[model samples]
Target: MNNILRAKNLGKVYRVGKIDIHAVRGVNLDVEKGEFVSIVGPSGCGKSTLLHLMGGMAKPTTGKVFIEGTDLSMISDGERAKIRRDKIGFVFQRFNLFSALNSQQNLEIAMQICHNGNIDHQRIKEIMKLVGLENKLQHKPLELSMGEQQRVAIARALVNNPLLILADEPTGNLDSANSYKVLYLLKDLNRNLGQTIVLITHNQEASKIADRKIEMKDGMIISLS
Candidate 1:
């Protein structure tokens, strides 16, 4: 198994006025290819901060984040952005879809913005099919249910064929039924597509869906199972 991501003694600090607030304190993590790992924590537990650091959205105040052997802190912002664009896919709690564009078009826009290049029709089709949204490709966001919209979001994350997926509270906006559906979809994606996923959630049941779950508290990891 290839170690796709490694965070060494990860730490982050935000300076406000004269105080230094530590958000993540010596939090280390490693994620291998084709693995589904969930980080579970309460709000303000620093899980989201860790996700941003891991995905290269923010630089850490201490330690280092390594993605596919590239040290996130040592690289230039443009280089990190390229690594993020080429290797990491992100899914947020809100289904960040374009309301005006249909599902396929939404995916097309993501591919275009990431590389400013042509779309891969076959890959798009395969991703849509994998997320079970093949029939909904022509439908706008408003036309689909919350669950379907989330499915589209997942497809959009996979459109680039990224090496890793970083999903933050992906089912936060869904009802229990929809949440279950979304979790099931994620499990299926991990198992069938062989996609590596690192899901961050406050929901315990949601975290259990992953192959391993790490619990965080007060800017540090407390348990892993």
Candidate 2:
């Protein structure tokens, strides 16, 4: 498989007064097309920071990130924003759904924003069904359970046919049963849709479903297998 993303000596540092906090340090990794890779670590390990850098949401303090062979650090902010909008999809722990809109409408808005008004109703329906939200299309986020809202978020992420899906603590807010449901859905997307997924989670069971796992500690990748 071809590499969809490549990171070379990637690092991030935050300054607080005179002290520098290293968030990520000298990480080199590659994610191939259509692979499910998970980064597992404790809090403050910079898992989310790595995902943000890969998605072009945050610039690395040192080193390079290449998405589809284009150097992300070399691109202008506007170009990077466009790259994120066109090539990457993000799912977060909060579910980030518009509470006022029904599930279908919420997905529609995502489609419009990603596709710029060329919404494909058929594709939207297919993705909704893939995430097991076909029957709950008209329900608002407030009316849905935590699991359902996350499913809607997953559907919205898939609506754009993104090259890579970045999920940050995707099941952190769910009960055990719902967590299993969401993980199963993510596995199915990898198996069936052939979507490239990069997930960051603290759950070991969740990390097991991934094809490859990287464990991080103190801003460094301690293990990769």
Candidate 3:
């Protein structure tokens, strides 16, 4: 299979007063197409930062990230933004849904921003059913439970048919039962829809659901198996 994402000698440093805080240091990673991979680490180990870099939301201080053989470092910001809009989807732990909009409206807004056509209501219905939110489409974020809101976020991420899904601490805000529900849904997307996913989380049990698990510490990937 082709490698959908690659990071070579990636590094990011933050200058705080006289001290340098190395968030990610000389890391290398490759994620294959249609693979479900998880990055697990303690807090402040740069897992989320790494996901941002991989998704083209942030530029690395050094090294390169390639998406489907295109060098991200060489691309213009607009080009990267286009790639992000069309090829990548993001689900955050906070379930970044708009408080003012209902679930279907939120997804429609995302489709508009991404310039996505084929906005079939039937497909939207299917996704809603897939995430177990068929009855909650007209509800606002505040009206739903945490799990339901997160599922809406997932539906919005899938609306564009993105090549890669980058989830950062997707279940962090949920209880154990809800966490498993979300994780199972993500794994189902990977297994059934063949979605390539790179998930960052601190939960070891959640990480174990991935096809491959990578452990990071002190700004470096310590192990992968």
Candidate 4:
């Protein structure tokens, strides 16, 4: 299978006055095209950091990341930003939606931003329908339940038709029922749309939806299954 993402000797360090904290250490990961992988770990385990590195959101202190064979560390910030904008989508633990905007408007705004004003109403409708939010197009984030809000966020993430989706604890804010729904939606996306996904979560059940599960501890990967 073709590698959609790869990390070689990836590491990140943060210096606080007198000490250097290793947020990630010699970590390596690869995600195949159209494959769904989950990274599971406790808080402070560096799983989120690894996600950021892979998505070109942060520079690695030492090591390299290749996304679709482009070396992230070797690119200029503007170039990397272009790659991220065109190829990667992100879902965070919090639904970072504009509280005032309706669901459809939220997605439309994302589409404009992602495509530099080339709004695709047809594609937006398709994505909203895919995420089961076609009926709630006029509902604002505050008007919707947490699950609905997350689904809107997911729809916005898909607005640009990105090649990879990096989700960091996307179900963390929801209840068990809602979390199950969200996880199932992610799995369905992979199964139906061939969407490549890398989800970071502490929930074992949530992680199980992925094709492979990687466990991390204290800044290093401890297991892959």
How much lDDT does each candidate structure score?
Answer: 0.92, 0.92, 0.93, 0.92
Which is superior by TM-score, 1 or 3?
A: 3
Q: Can you write out model 3's per-residue Cα lDDT over 134-198, one digit (the tens) per residue?
A: 99889999999999999999999998889999999999999999999999999999999999999
- How do the residues 64-141 of candidate 4 rate in per-residue lDDT, one tens digit apiece? 999999999999999898888788988989989999899989988877777888888888889989999888988999
TM-score of 1: 0.95
Q: Over 4 Å off in model 3, which ranges?
A: 116-118
Please write out the lDDT profile of model 1 over residues 1-225, one tens digit for every residue: 399999999999999999988999999899999999999999999999999999999999999999988899999999998888799988989999999999999999879868687888788888898888888889999999999999999999899989999999999999999999899998998998899999999999899999999999989999988
In order of appearance, the predictions have TM-scores of: 0.95, 0.96, 0.96, 0.97
Worst lDDT window (10 residues) for model 1? 113-122
Write down the RMSD of all candidates, one decimal each.
1.4, 1.1, 1.3, 1.1
Model 4: weakest 10-residue lDDT segment is 109-118
Model 3 residue 174 lDDT?
98
Candidate 4 local Cα displacement, residue 146, angstroms: 0.4
lDDT of 2 at 109: 87
